[model samples]
Structures are given as structure tokens and as C-alpha cells.
Target: MLCSCGSRPDRTGARRLVTPLDERIAALLLAEHAFAPATPGFVGVTVELPAALTGRHQLRHGFLSPRSPGTAALSGPPSPGLEAGIARMADDLDAATSLVGEVTPGGVRVALEAGLEGGGPLGLTRRWALAATLAPVLAAAFANSPSPEGWRSTRQARHRGLPVLRAVSDPRRAWAAYVLEQPGRGGPGLAGLARHVDALRPPVAARGHLEIDVADRQPRDGWRVVVAVTAVLLDDPRAAAAVEEITAPLAAEPALWERAARDALSDPVLAAAARACFVEAYGTLARHGARRDLRDQVAEFTERYVMRGRCPADDVLDAGAGFRPVPR
Candidate 1:
């Protein structure tokens, strides 16, 4: 699985507010940190891994770029090493402030893209369906961005304009139709269509690999739990089968995504699916001999949040105060 995180810098004293990092400052930070060779607006570094872990896949690389004037985006594949590659990338971004003044990273947003097992037209269609089915459960389980509007994941609620994937027998035709539906997008042929697809931010985006964009930005190292549980559920054979069955009933629910973002686990149907999926993932991690630390993290998260029908956002909401950065 490939993972990416977006973090905004917190104001020194006002934790809820953010400091902007303009493109010039971003470029300078990239150069000072030696996260090269710089692309148009992004700087990246190659992350070396043991051949045993990488197998046939190429060495993983991490990228840092400014998502907006105030937010930095860090992305990389999951690390099989001692530390996650994304964490290291965040560290570099936190440390380097050569051109820009000192700034503390805050409010992380994470996305994980899982590659299809085998390449085929039918496989692509099935993968799209699976991603769509699992999106709401994952979103509800990991919800963190709480707002006064009563939504557990305000960030997700704001994505109403983005497309939602539906279970389709022919994803290619569906995708083509989706693209054409957008104004000024119909004229794009194959190459242009590829670019258009890259730009669209759907709950589940098909970019060869299925990009799951439902989860809110996790807090501090809580991101590990998000990555571990998601990877295990999607990549493990037994867990995948279990989740497919667990999420089947959710596909037909009207306004499921809206419910997931607003009510989170408070919704009975989503709560049950999330509970079942987490149980399956926890067991799969143990049986598959996943790292002890990762297994422990998942177990702790399941106990603290999933089992109780709560999420990270509940902690923030219950605190009854403005959002504060959790100690790293």
C-alpha cells in the first residue's frame, strides 16, 4: 500500500490556527533538507528498503510538496523498516525551516492507495466495487476532524462535490461517463482523460491502484493504526474475504457516505460493519505474524475507539475545547 499525509503548521500559541508555507518557502525547505531532485513544485527522496521486503516492487520514494499556502503534503509507500517512511518525511518537513521561520506541524490528513493484485479488466471492475463498499466503514471508524457542525469528519463532509464510486459491472464505461458528465471534461481523449482522472478526488479513486480517501487525518502516531488496519484488511486474504462480506449490506444504504461523516459510528449499520471489520483485521494481524508493535497498536485502537462505537473525533468533541495538537 502507498500512503500520503497532509499537515498544516500550527500557530505558535494558537494551536488551532495555522501558518502558511508559500511555494517559495517550500522550495527553500526542500533544498535545505536535500529532499531532491525537485519536480515542478514537489521535492522527493528515495527510501531504501531491504530486498526481502520490496520483492519485485521498486525502491520506495517519499515526496514533500505544498498542498496549499498553509498545508504540506508528504507521501510514500509503507515502510517495512524500523520507522514508517511517511513519518521520516514528516520529520524532515518539521525540521527544515531555512527560508521560512520555525513552524510546528499539526492536523495530519492521510490517504492510502492499495494496488490491484493482478492486472485485468475484470479485476479492475471488482477492485473498484470493493473499494466503494469498504469506504464508508473505514471513514466512520477513523473519523477525526470534528467540528461544531456535529460532523465527526468535517473534512470528509466538505468533499460533497467529489464523486462517489458505485459498484459497477464495467468500471471503465462508468469512469468514462463520469468524466464526460463534468463540464469541459468530455473533449479529453485517452491521455487527457488520464490527467482528468488524476485531478478528481473521489472517496475511492481508481488510479491503477485503488486510492481510499475516506479516513480523516489521524493524530500524531495514530496514523500508524490507520495504515496498519487498512493494509491488513485490504491485503490479507482472509481479512479481505471477511470485510467483503461485512460491508455488503452497506452498499445499498442511501446517503451512506454522508451518514458516515456526520454520525460516524453513532449510525447503527456503520458501527456494526466497522466493529466486524476491525475484529477481522485484528485477528488477521496476529495470525499473519505481523510486527508486535503494529498488532498492539491495532488492538489498542480497536479497544479505545472501534469497540466502543467511537472514533478519534469523539475524543476531540468530548473534550469540549478547541482542537489542540496531541504531543508527538
Candidate 2:
């Protein structure tokens, strides 16, 4: 992700993302949901759901329960009592000040991706499965990233791929999307995104969000099945500023993003658009009056993509996440 964003690299964050998630999950139990107290440096799990919805699910502790394939029979249909319980759980989940996501039915259940990070408490699953799910998301994140500051050529930046993920990952599977994205108001592919449907022992049937109804309509043309989103909290001032900056460039090039995968090389108009994009990005970075050293970075990248005409580094490193097109 750092590579794609041209973020100048924050090793501290990179280390935390890789190591702590493993250490925290490795020692915790999987069957029951749990929440550990957030220490100073680590993220604090604080989740906030919209007022109208009280989503349901189990809330288990991590350190105590067996973090393996386990099952519990849930009898009876949905009730108000159950609803209240789920609400409290969601509140608790969001209590983490930093970041943590919760499952609607937070207990051990089926969702291909197996874990989420909103509403509090992170998730754990087989390492390989986790990798598979996250790989696609990272790709999407990078692809959506636009030109960063301090580059000569904006070139084929990977930061703009966030919007079109649904198109490629699950082109035909809308039901799979709905459950996977239930947290985001019932979009498709959530089940597949979750990654635990097959692993549950005495497997339980997934409900509305998880179920892929044949009757549900397919995704719209460009919207597709959104597998990745560049979720930026508007409340955080810095994040809010980023939202302003990132969106300006991304919204400027919707056509380029859509064609990056299939037509990155094939489409002539798109190639021209990509080349022009490098010029625009670097021009903007320089206009911002940043240090010359930083603006020069953007200039160099512009030449690399627009003038030199090469495949983006992001493509060779991570293609699925690749969106910004350099001259190929």
C-alpha cells in the first residue's frame, strides 16, 4: 500500500499492521467474541452505527474462548430482546477509540472473509484466507490512489482504483456482495468477503445479508460489486482534508479507472487521458507551493509515465490493485 501511494513509507505503521494483528489473534480464542482494552499506542476499538439500525449478532471475548471452528445452535426467530442485546454489543464494539469492526451476528458464523473491523473488535482466520481477502482490498486501495505530491510525472499512480473493485472481483455475483457489505447498507459480495462460510463446524445457515437470493437484481453497470472502499472518517480533520484531496483527482478520471484493467494498454483514448493525468497531477503539486524537492518528485514521475511510457511499477508489484496507467 505504501508503495502504491508514494507515501514516503511509515515503517512504524507497517510493522503494527503486520505484527500486532497476528500476536493479538494468535493468543486469543476464536469461538467466542471478545474485546481487549485498548492500550495507548494500539488502536482503540470505538464503533458507531447509524441511529435507525440496531444490527444483530454475537459478541464474544478473544483471549478466553477457543479461536477455532466451533458452533452453537441459535433457535427461534429474531426478537426485540435479541435486538437490544445486539445494540449493546455494537456500542461496546465501537467503544474502541481507534479502530475495530464487528460482525452483525458477531459470534462464530459464516462469511467467507471471516472478519471485519467496524463496530469494534478485529477478526482472525486462517492466515492464507486472510491474505487472499486483503490482497484484493489493498489492490483496490492502491488502484484508487491518485498522484501524490513531489513527483515530476503523476504517471500511472495506483491510488485511483477504489471505486471499480466490484466490477472485476465479482462481476456476476451480487448476492455474494450483499452479505459481504451488509455493514455498508446491504451491498453484495459481503459473504464471500467474510471468508468463513465453509469453515464453521455444524455449519449454520446465513441469513438475509449472507444469503445470495436468486431474485435480487444484478449490480448496475459501473457500481458492480464493491469489494473495496477508501473509507475516510470525515470527523478527523486530517482525514477530512485527505478526502478533499483524493476525491478531486479520482472523480476527475472515472473513465480512466474503469478501463485501467482491460484497456490500460489497449485503449488509445485512455492512454492519452492517462498521460495527461500525469501532467495535471504534477502541475497541481507544484502549484501547491510545496518544497521544490517534493514537487520535483511529481515531475520525475510525470516524465516516467507521460514521456517515457512504461508500465506502472504498481502493475508488476500488484496488478489487481493497479489502476493508474503509465504509457505501456
Candidate 3:
């Protein structure tokens, strides 16, 4: 699970705009704190992961990037140690920005990547399809970025015009065709294809592992619930099967992604799908011996939001003018 968080400097009682200098200073602080090397450009820090955590030497380093002015993009491998990874990254970010700024509420973005089972080209294609099919449903379930525009996930709404990976019989070919049709002067060579792939921010991306980038930033510790539910639904066999069935009809639904970001659970079809997905994940977490606290958190989230066809965004909307987001 890779997470990106945006923060701003709070001077006195006012929120100050984050500057490039502030980002540089935070990067240096994070590098020193993590004992990692700081680099120029977007990706700022690279921390070496323990072999025990990564299970290999090749996938050793995790990255911390200041891709956006006020954002810290922390990328790492998936669970069983993903929660700890997120915690460490969060702590590093907090320590790094203590003298400069604080992580903003609703500014965290997450990308959950699942490895393809029975590793092969076919497995890769199948996993990509599954991730694509689940993207909108997950987005609706976890929508958090509320705004005056009346959209549940303003972050997701901003993804309009970006490439969306659809369920296809041959994803590899579809991806190649999509890349070729991109309005760029990029070459048709392998290097150019690589560049195109790196540049596009599709809902579901194939990077060895299938990465789902749909959920909005959760509030406070709510990110844990997002990761746990997403991980369970994709990783657990039974849950994945159920999710496949639940979301199958969504393929025929018009402007599904738009509906997911706009209406969120207010859309009856999406609400029904989210409710079932959460239930499946809740059950899978228990049967798979997940931590008790994590299970409880998922249960609480489901009861408070999913079951009622609401999400965290509703809380912010409900608060109206007096609304104060959760503090970092």
C-alpha cells in the first residue's frame, strides 16, 4: 500500500501556503530521520527496507516523494506488514514537518497493490481486470473528500479525463492500444512505452502488481480501515469471488465512475454494491485471523457508514459551516 499525504504550515491560527523551500526542508528532515538519502525532484527520500519486510533484495527500498508541493508520497510493499509501514511513514512525515507544517485532514491518498496469483502473463491480465472492476466500488465505499461542489470524493472527481482500465479479454493489448492513442510525441519504442506508463494515472495500473488508486484520503486513523478492507477484498479468495459477482453488473452501468464520485452511496446501485463488499470483507477478516482491533474498526466503519449508505464525506457535509476536519 502506497500512501501520499498533503500538509500545510500552520502559523499562529492561520494556515499558510506550503512553499517549495518548505518542501525541501521537510525532505531533508525526513532523509536525516529515516537515515535515507535525499534526492532532488519529486522523489525525495529512499529508505532501505529490511529483507524480512520485503522478502527480497531487489525490492529493498521504499520511497518518499514530495510530488506535489505539500504532499509526501510514501510508497512501499503490501501487507502483512503494511500497517507498520504506513505508521513508520506517518511518523517520519510528522517528525519531518513538525518544524514546518502538519499533515492535512482529507489530504492523504492511498494505492493498494495486490500481487498476481500463479504468476504469468495470464495472471497479470486477470488481476488487472479484477482491480479495474473493483475500482469504482471501492471509491464509493471509502469516499471522504467532501466539498461545496456537492461531490462526495472531490479527489476522485478530479480524476475525470484520466485513463480508466476497463474489464477486457486482453488487457495487455488494450493497454498498448491506449498508450499508442495518447496525445503525445512519445516514441513507439520500449523506453517511450515505459515513459507513457509512468505518466498516466489510471484508476487501476499494472506495475508488476495490480494497483488500485481509487479511494479518497481517510480521516485520522481511518486509513487503516481503508487498507484493511481493500486488502481483504482483493486477497481473500472467497471475498474476491463475491466481489466479482457483485460488481459484474457495474460493467454495464453508464458513467459508473462518474456516479461513484458524484453520488457515491447516494446512488442506489453503488450503495448496494458497497454494502455487500464491506460485508464480505468483514467476514473474510474474521475467518482469516486478522487482528481483533482491525476487525472491530472495519465493523464500526461498516455500521456507521456502509450499512447506512453513507461515508466519511457525509460527516463533513453534515457539519456544514462549523465543520472542522480532524486535526493531525
TM-score of each: 0.67, 0.24, 0.69
TM-score for candidate 1, please give it: 0.67
Tell me the tens digit of each residue's lDDT in model 1 across 73-130.
4446434422354455445544334323453333333333333334332244455566
Q: Highest TM-score among the candidates is held by which one?
A: 3
List of clashing residue pairs for candidate 3: none
Per-candidate clash tally: 0, 73, 0
Q: Which digits, one per residue and each the tens of the lDDT, describe model 3 over residues 144-164?
A: 776666678766775544434
Q: Score residue 50 of candidate 1 by CA lDDT.
A: 13
| C-alpha lDDT values of all predictions | 0.58, 0.27, 0.58
- Candidate 1, which segments miss by more than 4 Å at Cα? 1-60, 77-122, 159-166, 182-195, 323-328
Model 3 clashes, total count: 0
Better of 2 and 3 by TM-score: 3
With a 3 Å backbone cut-off (N, CA, C), the pairs that clash in candidate 1 are none
